[model samples]
Target: MGAAYEGLSEKTRTRRFLASVLHLTETMLDHLVDDVDGVDHVALALVGVGDDRVGVPTAIAR
Candidate 1:
């Protein structure tokens, strides 16, 4: 997830958060991955399948 976030273009990141999000704080990461009940909030990731990029999200849906 961190790797994926780091890969986001500045324009994409800004569009996502409605601001310039340079990096994820631990709390933000926890919230993104852990908080928000699935009943109301959901996130889906499309990740790279293998090699050094394994598990890195290529795209995401929320």
Candidate 2:
């Protein structure tokens, strides 16, 4: 017989995961704004978490 799945609380886990995703998204947005105006002091620079961090920098050519 398969393990009991009835004890798993899907709703709670889903809410927690969504909250975490929202927080990370907000952090990215804050970093974006800081990089744009370049008029404020930012504690954490925008850097990738893993092996994908190294890449070419982009500039808004206008």
* Top-TM-score structure, candidate number: 1
Per-residue accuracy of model 1 over 32-51 as CA lDDT, tens digit each:
87876777888877888887
Model 2 off-target regions past 4 Å? 1-24, 35-62
lDDT of every predicted structure (CA atoms): 0.85, 0.41
Clashing pairs in 2: none
Residue range 1-62, candidate 2, lDDT tens digits: 01222243666435644542322344554554445553454343443355776754343221
Error of 2 at 24 (Å): 7.1
What's every prediction's RMSD, in angstroms?
5.5, 13.9
Candidate 1: which stretches are off by over 4 Å?
A: 38-62
